[model samples]
Target: MKKTIQRPVVPPASVSTPVVSPIYPSVVYASDDPDGLDAQYEGGAAGYTYAREGHPNADLLARRIDALEGCSGGIVLGSGMAAVAAVLLGLCGAGDHVVGGNQLYGRSLRLMAEDLPRLGIATTLADPTDMAAVEAALRPETRLVLIEVVSNPTLRVADIEGIARLCRDRGVLLAVDNTFTTPLAVRPFALGADIVLHSVTKLLAGHSDVTLGWVAARDPDLAVRMRVFAVTTGMTPSPFDCWLAERGLATFALRFDAAQRNAAALADWLAGQAGVRRVLYPTRADHPDHNRAAALLGGQGCNMVSFEVAGGRKAANALARAADGVAFAPTLGDVGTTLSHAASSSHRALSPEARAAIGITEGFFRVSVGLEPLDALKTTFAAGLAAARDA
Candidate 1:
């Protein structure tokens, strides 16, 4: 009975391999040869000995992400913000400067504006869609330039190719957050971006059940550096979460296509509605970055839509209440359509003036379009708009 406690059930090795990736929940691994463990620790052998240093689940997911982004290597982190932190802290040290877009996600904005400053790293916020602004923000000490493929809620697309070129000429690393568009819409690495980041908890996972993120680098050395930082800081993701995200990723393409179709329909419907003050979709002709998005994304729109209502918070609340079955959650990228109020949700950390400076307002709402019946969603939006008008 005591011996049983020291040993667990073991399955016989079979010729057949698993169709799905098996989760390796072990915290420690044993090697037949004592020198084999030393070899792994010294990077002479290709194997994992500790969960914190490396794990099979993380390695597999990282490889899959690398393949999708067409990059040499990448690393998986515990959360989306962890990926961002790893890149900044690993690549840029004290006295280094980083240039980022002004329209970044709120938490990202805080990380740059507040967190990095504490570490002696300086950050410059610029409009990523404007080449002039990005180029002007670059300083001699600038080490990294970060931008989102698309501005959150506002749906403004950035000029990745142009920025990549500018960063290259200045010997600066360009990191593009590909969460909104994903690899399906655009591959930043192919466009010459040095680094690509993703909030896998969103679109990549396709479902909101797991929290995961990754940073892929065109340069293999940078990928290794990021992974080393993640491991050192104990930012590793759980094997079970990685397994869940991989499962979600398996159906990502199909789910994304269906959600995109519904989003386009919703955008069209909102454009014709009386209460809708504005509609923001990349593919829409009236969008500020319409032509650029068309050229970059090849005429395919993403699964996100944002629109402004006529009134302020009152109108937004009424609309949310009227929309039956759709949740008004702060997060996005679920199989079911959901709504998020920009001022109260994503940009809540910002002051009213700061939020207004970036186009976020009381009446602004972002929709995470999902795999739902187009007609049914339209009906819900129509009712919501009517309710807003009455409010």
Candidate 2:
């Protein structure tokens, strides 16, 4: 048969395969038989017709995520917030209510509190660490309750098992954001979470390169529904991004372990520093939720630390400026150490009173500890502390 301009020849299958999975960037896939393509579209046969609906890279990554999360199925989306939106919009309808932790990622809080309400989906925010607060916020109309395994900026660990039990008793679906404490540390599904969400842009991807997210469910029906919603709403992630994320995920355990070690050392160092007022790490004995974090996270502190400088915003800025080799990037889970000013970056959406109530003062800085050597990070932080003292 003569191949035309529209029809390209495909190479024959080889006996030997490449070690790395080949990236399939083609947006449209072709089949020789029209009936075959029709069957694929009809869901009777397995094939990729379009990138948005399904693709090799995404499917491969999703399967791996499902295995890791110990779930029946999972779906990958464009970004962390995209996964959040899918869960909210897919299962929820107008007049539905949602209860979320106040300590959730600022963007998540805004999405539920401000944006969803516009669609007649009311939201209630409460302390995730307190079971009473979580239960109190739930309404009969509440469809879902969302909380983070470990909150952003503040690093307060939630009672996943307790919250999960409460949600189950109330017949509300529970979604837990496991971004901070990845599956390497804690698996939310095992603790009874109905849906597990991840900002793969963080620890799962390990490197700060890709912006991706995923939602995993043990229920096949919920997983299928989420997949449909993601496809229809165009929350599709790039194939190249998925490829890159898979590459990063390969070394996640190593990177996460090293980062955790660095964080522990950094926390200990900061506690003894003159200008450091306080340090918040899950495993730290001084932390308020230390016992809960230890029980839930298996004594693994994960790779994040939030500390307060003695002075306020001015001191924090000076510390960030003087911190040698540490970038003041707002993002986390990088190969290199970086700092984020909570009030200015992560929690900027909240009002001054709201932020203050959460203990995100101007001097508060959250560190995404990386795979840097303990000694090296200590030196960099020492410089920052000195700057903070001088300021």
Candidate 3:
């Protein structure tokens, strides 16, 4: 396997991009070019013509993520779904097949189950942790193998490098949703992933205020196709959202560090509690993919910690309500700690059997650790646990 380091390209003098405004955290503008040129120069030819087709903010953000992912280039999308849809629709057409991870985001599962089929694309769901299962699920018509860097809700880290090798050998595209573990925690491209996607709404944005997404690839051709699909489908992020994500990127390294530390501490504490039926974190020795996660992801686990309560849905609901100061929100990755009942919030669309197969139980709750003081978060969890035990 060959690895390439991609450096950011400086836009030519004629392309005058905007300076991010200090007051508006989420908006930026491209000022008029000093040369009075309306287009970008790419070897004496125009590359970026319009905002929808291409914008300075989008390109800058893309380059930053490319650097983070160690990829050739990247495409920023309107949302995470747009990024996934662009990759799937751009890479595959009628009669093509897709092998997807069984434990995926609800919307992604819906896209695979309902939407892709409508376009004549067939899909097979497999346990990504099982290399043999993923390999066996591949077919001649399979155009892409889709997975998440870390499974949503479950927090199971996939064997990304192995899966990438499998895709390369099969002559298929490998795409990973790197939302849960942002590039700060894991670089999917370096792990052999052909394409890496992000729902900038989560850890990437750091704050819970923005909704944006991006897709990066080591292959220039793949990047071009995704850009074309994005422009044709009008799935570009607002200049405002792009600016917000960029601002978020500046603090990403710091925030993720603190959040992950808190998450690990919380996971360790939860494991010993009498009411905790299970604790799932990649760094945990008992995690199913602990070794693979350690080998591929290094020592830093993601900020998410998921666990099961002893009393099923009733206890889980009680725990959520019992937490003081922590917001019992369905979303994750904020400056303040947040919790969600996955069985009802993220996995609600799945059937009971499907949810069970994916390790999403009625007692499961996902906690996204934030930068809050560790003691405060621990106190909140302790209170929640005590309530759950009483329930």
The true-versus-predicted C-alpha distance at residue 178 of model 2, in Å, is 0.5
Cα RMSD for predicted model 3: 8.3
Candidate 3 collision pairs: none
Per-residue error for 193 in candidate 2, Å, reads 0.4
Kindly list the per-residue Cα lDDT of model 1 for residues 46-66, writing each as its tens digit. Answer: 987878887889888888878
lDDT of 1: 0.90
Model 3 CA deviation exceeding 4 Å by range: 1-49
**Per-residue lDDT tens digits of candidate 2, residues 127-186?**
999999999998999999989999998999898899999999999999999998888899
Instruction: Provide backbone clash counts, one per model.
Output: 0, 0, 0
Q: What C-alpha lDDT, on a 0 to 100 scale, does residue 250 get in candidate 1?
A: 90
Q: What are the lDDT scores of the predictions, listed in order?
A: 0.90, 0.90, 0.85
